[model samples]
Target chain A: MYEAYWRGMGDRCSLVISGSEVMSYLGGNPGGACWFLEPELEKSIRRIHHLVGNAAAQAEDGGHVVVGTGSTQLLQAALYALCPPDQPEPTSVVCAAPYYSCYKEIAELLQSKLYKWEGDAHNFNKDGPFIEIVTSPNNPDGLIREPVVNRPNGKLIYDLAYYWPHHTPITHKADYDIMLFTFSKCTGHAGSRIGWAIVKDKEVAAKMTKFMEVTTIGVSRESQLRAAKLLGIICDDCQAFSTNTKSQNFFDDSKRLLTERWDKLHEVVKRSETFSLAKFPKDYCLFSDRFYETHPAFAWLISNNKVKDCASLLRGHKILTRSGNRFGADATYVRVSMLGREEEFNLFLERLSTIKIGICNGIAHIN
Target chain B: MYEAYWRGMGDRCSLVISGSEVMSYLGGNPGGACWFLEPELEKSIRRIHHLVGNAAAQAEDGGHVVVGTGSTQLLQAALYALCPPDQPEPTSVVCAAPYYSCYKEIAELLQSKLYKWEGDAHNFNKDGPFIEIVTSPNNPDGLIREPVVNRPNGKLIYDLAYYWPHHTPITHKADYDIMLFTFSKCTGHAGSRIGWAIVKDKEVAAKMTKFMEVTTIGVSRESQLRAAKLLGIICDDCQAFSTNTKSQNFFDDSKRLLTERWDKLHEVVKRSETFSLAKFPKDYCLFSDRFYETHPAFAWLISNNKVKDCASLLRGHKILTRSGNRFGADATYVRVSMLGREEEFNLFLERLSTIKIGICNGIAHIN
Candidate 1:
């Protein structure tokens, strides 16, 4: 989906690195909170975030940017930082229902003594200190959400992976204690495996940095330098074309592509009897300076009773999707990725439109 | 020390990447055991290892290569793979005394329930299942080591970070069940944060790959590709100059530089009364085709009883060193890095030659 956009942009975003540059283990900012984080990359992240008005990255707030291999590592780092090591019992980690599928798996992967996955936040009944992961413009459901568990001792990790203006409206600048953003969703450079956390508290940031050092010894400097270059290009384009609505900036271009895909998906869903798409209301985006509907990276599709398993039904048509059960939702729902190549997405829409409720009953047997 | 070698190589090892290349989350080998492992990088690693005669990476052995963010992550992955999740007790993970300091720190960082750090493999008397990490040409005290605990349930992870021909002689091709290597030590590309595991069992390889996916999604593609390019250059140099000793190859060039530094340090140690260096016997190196003494990246310096704290004593002289206490040894020893730039290495030798045993007692007070 984003390949064409980057290709059309030509060498303006390309990178050339010398063999001897950035070869040492320590990064440029050795004395900062994240000793291994490249200073230029940190500056680029703050500039982009401030330009987008998504998160508070100003130096006055004492926000420290801790870079990770990806947001996945950042998620684990956050859990490790928030949970007290000497606590008698493991800290309960909870997220809302229909949350990202990886939260539980990542939390329990190492079976850390400091924290344990306690399932959905709505069902969390414990009164002790807890950590709630709030994914705004959430993964499976594609809905903006806030923390469901309200407690004085509760901590929050806001995974704003999909909070960019192209995916969701620039809903007021998210002022949170900890916020995570990734280069994957923002610039469609998932292979770089670069993500950063904008943490407000100095101690928490230091602990997070320690987690990075103990885990992978810090994120890749090659990726950090490359990400800095890419983010600089994005910021440069935004500055040059801030008032030009017709110019194809990164956000505007991505939004245009996503809107077209969403429009096609809406048409397909309206005609289908076996599946229904989640509806999102129009919201004003400060970056684009207009009201727009969220054309999310994922489509939350609910299947009718005729289809016993939405994921299995889609599999019959050769369309791969994640089952809602993985996200703590009923199996009647399936999350379809809307970020595929154009031809592949067209094939998915074509296959999905042909999947009628009558055929849903015996689709598995026929396939 | 290795920086000058790489800088001398110039743009032959430099990398130019287009914006559209390697943008997808998936790698070229999506169906591989390590799905996110780049195919070219895997091929390059196998080629380099085969060329160096260090590890068994041949395709005929059905060996699988699992790439990680670095060898640090791979060590954790090896633990996760060797220790069964359903075990009644946490598997004891031990390395020999004077082991890599990070082995203990990384193992216990998460307080993992699957494995616990059981210090000093020589003292590990438990008869149950255990994971032993064997660091040949070890970090602090450079020496070849093998597992001391002989048991049927014991699993071994060979940390060959310093096994390159530049650091130690290649005695034979290692045919271990699991072997860990990193690009940081191989080419002094520490900022790349790339490492890999060669495993004989497919199940173990798959489990290690799963750990990588759950932890970091995968290592950075930019780093992986850059590593592949750098390794390719080394392999090409070896091929082009295999018969000529006069021509500069990667290993020969690095070994020459390391030999000079070691010679200077030996002269200083011979004259200093307060410090003694570790002894290493000359062994036949197949790659260099000569008998060569080990020139480890770190110097294990033992201080006399006059110095109470070796690390503190060095700190007073403006030298940063890790105390032997961190490596589970007495405080009379300190690990000094010999991999600094040429000027830094000279300054260290100059300062060490001026220090006498009489000053050790009053060093803390004078500083």
Candidate 2:
């Protein structure tokens, strides 16, 4: 689990990655060490300012940009800035169920109540007095929904953390008051800790900037430069990689591998006949039917009677899976990351088959 | 100035520097993303348990470590946590003159009153009812003073931003209620945005942590790893470089170069008779002497009204220097960074000589 978390989020382009480029821009000066000033630092700042404009131009509304230590920091900054302590704190934050789990907790930590709108596969009810946190292609589920209503007076902070490649560009919806995005997700560099917010309203952006200044002062210069560098690199890569025939062929190969694993897991669950499918949204890319079978709570059901939770069964076979409870769901559900090689998935299948035979024959006790 | 800031603060091993390291360690993740969980993030809660132990070890009284985007954010967090909105705010923060300038601005931004205890080179008065901000070997003008007496029940937040290499360690002193330090200075990485506080009281630390959790969540994980990596490298460098005779020789050569510039500047100031020595105790470093001629205020004086008020004259030469007013001192003064190379200093002196010659002949104007 630790390895997965680290590998999934920890692969980042270190600041040293662009040292040569930075040095070239710096006129061979190793760094701005002699004085408390550097021309390259100024140049980097100007570059960021330009990028901000570029990002703003791409947004639905051309709003002011305020940067933060990361999008996570900016999220907290937005809440603190918008939600005044003097007022009765908003009754609760309205978030889609299976949303980014942090939104509810952050709101609760701020003493704000949370209201979950359990949006299943087909529906989203938009009416709510509370601030709405809308994530496109939401985490865990990875399904995109464009809410029909435009809530003007109602505060809305959109988490566009995963909206880059997979989801449609709905930033032009003209309803989002604040939008958040991080470099970690888009560029496969999670560690630089750079994120920015695009607020349609100037007054809102100003408050957030002030809040950020007081909070983290500013994002790290090193991270900002590296972010700018990686952003340029990734944008180029995205354009090139998307068009390459080989890349498309590779995608097909990967999908085939994933489908096979999904089918095998489906067969296993069907054969066991001990569990029934709760709900499987076809629109969701990840979180397939296999996710339901191996959940800890369901595993608990089987474990008490010679059955094992999917995560534990997978884990017993050296496969790591995230406990569903971590995502504000029942422990009976476990999330198996769909990110693995075909061989790895086959290995996971082999382990599940072994566990199933043992449990059915009363050779292995669930407990 | 930006270059100087980096040269003074940037780490050698890691390109990124910031105060995010505190959260990375405490929250067990690099970025403060856990703070945004819809449900409480389990890792954050689990990490906090271990952080409490670490904090206990670091603090005089058992305390908790609340993570912030940076020490600056923590500063604001401390303000939010301590100052009640219900009561009339405290009249002002009584910071030592020539202190870190951010103290007054942060207080004012919070709408608190601000007062200055203008300390001359010889002595600083120790009496005050206001929150006191103390900096040892302070910025621009480095000065360290031993604490005389504790003001019973009064608040003191020490800025130890530069208290790493040049200043003596005083973390052992249990008198301070809160102390702030950043990885930027010690580890030479300001981009990671990691800073920490040692609060003598557990309640104070807890309050601060809550504010941080609400405001910034936690620092970045990628930054933390980079910092941890850089810190190891810095420690290794310190050990390796300190023992190397060649490194000592390099410093000796650099000091000789600096001494020549200082002597030339002293001679020019003596001949001009426009500026006089700023008094200091016998134990003060040679860098203090640069203030007379190289300081922005002094240069400003020479360039304005045939050497009139130091602030205006310095501006005329296209030289950027911080006015003393920013640091709660008389407008006649300005702080200049003495971190330039010998050639840079020589060029500055040449400009000064020309300005002096122009001023004496009434050819220079304050405009």
Candidate 3:
């Protein structure tokens, strides 16, 4: 859907990688030698981590960063590192209800005896070693979440994929033991397939690097270099435009556009009796030093009427959405992607506004 | 080691990826719909396979090709697909002795209950389902190999990373259920981290795609596009330089240089009584339709006498080589990479030739 949008934009989000940018297989060594990440990517990650006041900035030594093909790969790496192979029983891995579908699938599909996907984190009460995946500013619902499975043996993997300034409040320097960030949501460069993690423990960092070594050897150096270059541009722009919200940095511009789209979407949702949307309260942002509106990557839509499968209803309206069932929730809730091109979003709004819900005995029904 | 060599070559091997190369994420689709793989990459792969008469060249319908981050990930994917998770016992994965060290390490490190690293293929006589990894023009030994354990339940994975024109004679179109290839070994773009597989079975291909879906989602579009462009250049050059022995294509130039280096290394080894090297005979070529000599990526060096651990001995002489133990081989052998920069190789040769070997009673000692 966004392909046509990007094609129309003519290199708006894409980046050019120079011929000589890639010349070595070793990006950064596993032992915090800066060899696990491409040098420029490492530098950019450090700069951005500092600018965002996220986990890396809070560390005494900037923490150890592990670069991956994407946050999904990092997610897998985190799981691989935390779980030992010889666990007596498969270590239960869980995420909260309305979680990212990929987590459940990846955990189950990799299917190690050391770990098993055991559904919602809220339901798990297992005493043995377990892993809880925490997706903050959650994928579908756009809610800030904390680990609910507060067990002593439970480890938390905070996926900060959408914690960028544009998506949520800066809040604080998010220092944590393990955290993941991606260029996809932050810079809208999903095609690059680059993501990174900031780990306080060197052992965990080394283990994550080992995971990468066996999986893809390492992420693409070209993608890493391209991400580095783009991050540099964004940081430089932010510096120049720090005083003004109308400045041309990526977050400023992306947020403004998202704000308008969200308003339009809200208006459309309000007019419909069949569907409702998740509400995110304004939060105090450290970067802006003020309350900021939410700009989520997706709209978690709930059926307020007889629409049992919101996704199927949306499909009938010619506006495709991912079913809440994919996220281990009921079919009444669906996730609508908010990260597409401007035209794609506009079309989604147009189709959604025109959607006619079915009525039975004066009750609103599926569209 | 090769970093300075490439830095010295400047743009001789480097590739330029245009800004517009990665405007979309939908490469060819998993169902062979041309949605998951970049169009150019798919085309270039098809062309190269056809030109070289390699794996896909002999396919009945051009077979299914799955692109990965590198063959390492594909290696994992293949293992995931071929082995059922519910198998009562873990399937043993074996490569020949003196194999690529990463194979065993990756198999063990991933540690899925479905598969276990079972040392050398020669030692595996397991009754149940197993995977035999055959690296033709094998990693360290440069010996063409077949599955020794040809059990009905045994699966064979052909890693043809070195079967290209530069490394070895393209003997025939390799039609196999699973075959692996990489741009790193072929085009010297290790930084790209892109590799692919030609799988005859659709079910297996789908499984591989599923693995990517849960891992990185897909390879970098920029890397894929870059690989496609480079492959196009190589294939085109191969076409134009097909008949000319003095042709200046990449493979031609690379092979010419490798031939010279191999000859020089052989000369150096001839002067020493303590070392011996693997020898390859001329083979009939299907790509060029003529006999061609070998130019392996790694040199298999055996310590004939005086040095029990050849890699350790080389390290003492200030030269680095992979120990034979890493490949489940005896300590008398070592694997030396041949693709390093010109200066690095020269230095390695100088150090290796001047190394003093211990002698017993005026005779070269076996220890």
Chain A only: TM-score per candidate: 0.96, 0.60, 0.92
By TM-score, who's the top model here?
1
Tens-place lDDT digits, model 3, residues B1-367: 3244334434544555433345345655544722367767877888888887766643356477788998999999999999988888998998878789999877877457889999888888778989999999788788887878777788989999988887888887788888999988887889899898888888898888878767787889888877887788777767878667655567667777888899989989888666898789999877666787787888888887736677877887788888888888887788899888789899988877886577677554322
Local distance difference test values of all predictions, in order = 0.89, 0.47, 0.79
Deviation in Å, model 1, residue A335 alpha carbon? 0.9
lDDT of 1 by residue, A1-367 (tens): 8888889888988878888888998987988999999998999999998899998987876788999999999999999999999998899999999889999899989888999999989999997889999999899777999899988789999999999988999978888999999999999999999999999998999999999998899889989988999888889888888766565688888989999999999899888766788789999988778998888899999875546588987898899999988998888889999999999999999999888665544563322
Poorest 10 consecutive residues of model 1 chain B by lDDT?
A: B358-367
Tell me, by lDDT, which candidate is best: 1
> In candidate 3, which residue ranges exceed 4 Å CA deviation?
A1-21, A28-34, A58-61, A243-247, A358-367, B1-24, B28-34, B58-60, B243-247, B359-367
Each candidate: chain B TM-score = 0.96, 0.62, 0.90
Q: Against the true chain A, what TM-score does chain A of candidate 3 give?
A: 0.92
lDDT of 1 by residue, B1-367 (tens): 7788888889988878888888988988988889999998999999999999988898886789999999999999999999898888999999999889999999899898999999999898987999999999898888988888878899999999999999999999988999999999999999999999999999999999999999988889999999999999999889889766566688988888898999989888988767888779999998778998999999999986447698887887888899999998988889999999888988998888877656644663332
Per-residue lDDT for A1-367 in model 2, tens only? 1122223223352235221122111222223221111233333333432332223323234554566766777776676566554443242355555556566555443222222233221243444344556766566555554543345545677877655422222232333568787755444344456677767777777777666555465565555656565455334433455467443222223234444555566686566553333333433222111222111111111232333354565566675765555565544445655444446666755655555433546554432
Candidate 3 TM-score over all chains jointly: 0.92
Q: Can you give the DockQ of every candidate in the order shown?
A: 0.85, 0.17, 0.51
